[model samples]
Target: MKPGTLRVWSQVHTWSSLASTAFLLILCLTGLPLIFHDEIDALGKAHKIEQWDEAQLVPLDHAVDVALAKRPGEVPIYLSFDEDRPVVNITSGRSADVPEAEMGFQPIDRRGAVAAGGGQTGGVTDFLLDLHKDLLLGQGGMYFIGLVGLLFVAATVSGIVLYAPFARKAGFAKVRRAKAPRIGWLDWHNLVGGVTLAWALVVGLTGTINTLADPITAWWRADALAHLTSGEGGAVQPYRSGLVQKAVANAMAKAPGMRPQFVAFPGSPFSSGDHYAVFLQGATPLTKKLLTPVMVDARTGEVDAIAPMPWYMKGLLLAQPLHFGDYGGLAMKLVWTLLDLAMIWLLGTGLYLWLGRIRKRAR
Candidate 1:
């Protein structure tokens, strides 16, 4: 690149970082708690069933029935499996994901359901996730952060362009403690940012991709959902959940002892007809994250097809675990968390440097 081009890139890097620093700071702050969300949630009080074995597992529908028996008007909103417990959560509510803002999530177990431990899912962890994903603003907040992520990428590329010239003046680690305040801050910003480049860019890009989840999923449903139709329509109208229930049962019968990772309901652009879209996880490490979904016909409750994920959708699915870093152990989590904090530090110093330069010019 020419000297002029490098200078222009540097200007962009400086201004872009300055423009989004505050929001980015909030993201980093909230992101910290989420890094340890699993660990933190584990610290809480738990209900241990001494005899969950019952010699065998009970039908999930039975558990759902138990939950509904407790909350009459409520419908099953979420049925989450415990990562390390025999507890099954049956959250009942309206079609809208979260129940009313006032009456939050209600967890259910095998024997019965109860309104227990409803003080912000993971306390600080939930706070951070909400703030980071949507800034507690719901969908709008998520998009805004996604846009910030886009700008972050642009700024990262521009920063690298600027780095080439900056390196001409000094070595990679040449931080001068006695330099002018602007120079000192800039050095620190670059120091932290440079080392964290790979992680930051990956996090920013993947996070941005996650932001487009609603749309991407819609697109997938539009295209792939039809794939389930077998060149026919009218099988789904109003999307009865029972159709999905029937379909899931059919798929499970065919899967032969395979466990369900998650299920997509019908009429949801995410699902077709009433047939349930069931994803089965591989029992092996190499294929655990890889899933093959079985499509069941909504009306007939019969198996439609058991197929591999579309290449694009499969890539997206795999990217999720990689981005979150939850696939690995504590050491991996710590590394990701530390890098996240490094991003926070880099953002802080970069903002300080940008402001310092502005004040200098003003003086």
Candidate 2:
């Protein structure tokens, strides 16, 4: 590369890295615990439900009834199943459009129709997730984080471009420990950064995609489900007979092989005002996160339409698990954790080198 072009790339690499270092550090720190959130969450549980026969499991209506009994005036917003156990988590609030903070979660045991655990809403993991995702600033914070992710990507690409020239003489992964501390740190940063380049790019890009989750969902609802959502009836009332259960069964019948992931009640963000949107998941690991919505009539319990996710929605769904290493099992999570640690080190070393240069210039 020409010296002028090299200088411009160098400046890009330096400024971009500097601009995103703090936010990247926050993400890396919060993300480490998140990679193992499932394991960490399991530690505090006082009750564990044993596996039960499918026939012995209680009806979905019964679980919703029990959950509603706990909060008399609240309406059911969502009903979700546990993948491994005979448990159903019911989310309720004053209305379908209730804020998440005001919602109540009850995990009912399907075998005995009893409350299994209190709730998984507020906790350290949730706090870390909120921080990592949007810095607790909601939609605006997500956009900011997305911009930071872009900066991080810029830094990574520029670093890769500059690496070839730097390593031409020193060779790859060569650390001159006998020289100045900054030189050694710079070499270490480049080596580690190179080793984790692909993984970093993947995570950065996916995370940026994840930041647009709300907008993507909104767009999907407006475009794909416009026909269903534009219906005349008002939101369905909760506990109005056995409509919820029937709608779920109808949804399951429509999609024979898939399992019910969650049910979005009428007037909720995931559903139309008069439809129960039952989100189903496939059996395979890759397809499990990619959900297909089966819209059922909340009032009549009839199958309205099966809405397949659009390409952008599918991309968002796929990006989420890949970003969190949730696609693979424990082994993948461990690998993600190691990469996160290396990223932290890379960011730290880069900051150190940049500060050293500034200090030397000052003198």
Candidate 3:
């Protein structure tokens, strides 16, 4: 790049990183625990059920019945499975649209027995997740964080551009300790930031994409999902809990290789009022996040339609786990944690350099 172009890129890099560094720092700190959220949650959870010689898993409806029997007046909202064990996790609430804070979680063994200590939420882990996701500001906060993510991406690109010019005289990753404090800090910032460049970009872009989830889901409901259910009846009457198993079966049958991940009951956000949306996922790592919704008539337990997930929804699904760094197991999570710490160091050095320059200007 020309000297003038390099200077412009340098300016862009400085301003962009400075503008987003604080928010980015918050994300990094909060996200550190979130990368190992599973491991942390496990620490607080009860021990897994002892594996029997041959444990025959109960039907989905049986698990739902057992879970609801424990919490009277509650309705089943979602059913999730344990990846490693023959266990099912069921979430229930008073109503279909009840908030997550009011929901109850039940982890049941293969025999439909509720585990000793597994029906709760709102812990330190959840708090950290909420903070990292939205700064505890809900939707508006989420969008703002997303904007920071975009700035971070721009900063990353500009930094790469300027690296070519700035490092012309020095080797990449060189620390000029002989220089003044500001210059040394600047070099440290560049080196650490560059080292974590790929991960930072991936997390930033994916997080930005995730923040659009609300709008993207709204659009899907307004367009594709609505179109799929246009000819269906208006509001569906309340259906019995017995239909949960049938709905799961119908969904799994529709997608031969996929397994039911969760069931969105009638009047739920993900399902039409007239149907139970049984969300299925493939067993493979890549397809696990890509959910396919199979709508079943709530009253009749008949398969209504199997709609292919739209691109935007799929993008969100893929981005979430990727951003969380949970897809690659313990090794990947450790890698993510190390990179997160590096990002913190990079932000700190950048701030130090900026403050030093401001002090020099004032003097």
Task: Name the Cα RMSD for model 2.
Answer: 2.2
lDDT value for model 1: 0.68
Distance from true position, residue 159, model 3, in Å?
A: 1.8
* TM-score against truth, every candidate: 0.83, 0.92, 0.89
Cα lDDT of model 1 by residue, 260-334, tens digit: 665554443445655556777666764656777787665567778887667767766766766677878888889
Q: Could you tell me which residue pairs clash in candidate 1?
A: 243-274, 244-274, 275-298
Query: Where does the lowest 10-residue lDDT sum fall in candidate 1?
Result: 95-104
- Expressed as tens digits, the lDDT of each residue in 1-363 for candidate 2 is 999999999999999998999999999999999998888888856545566799998888889999999999988899998876888999999998887788999999989899986566678999999999999998899999999999999999999999987788678889989988777888898899998999999999999999998899888878887765564455454547588778988989999999899999887888888888999998887678789999987779999899778899899998988799976799999899899999999998898888888999999
Q: For candidate 3, what is the TM-score?
A: 0.89
Question: Ranking under TM-score, best-scoring first?
Answer: 2, 3, 1
For model 3, the superposed segments whose C-alpha errors exceed 4 Å read 1-8, 44-58, 69-74, 113-116, 231-233
TM-score of 1: 0.83
CA error at residue 315 for candidate 3, angstroms: 1.1
RMSD of each: 3.7, 2.2, 2.7
Candidate 2 at 177: error in angstroms?
4.1
What overall lDDT goes with each candidate model?
0.68, 0.88, 0.81
- Clashes, model 2: 0
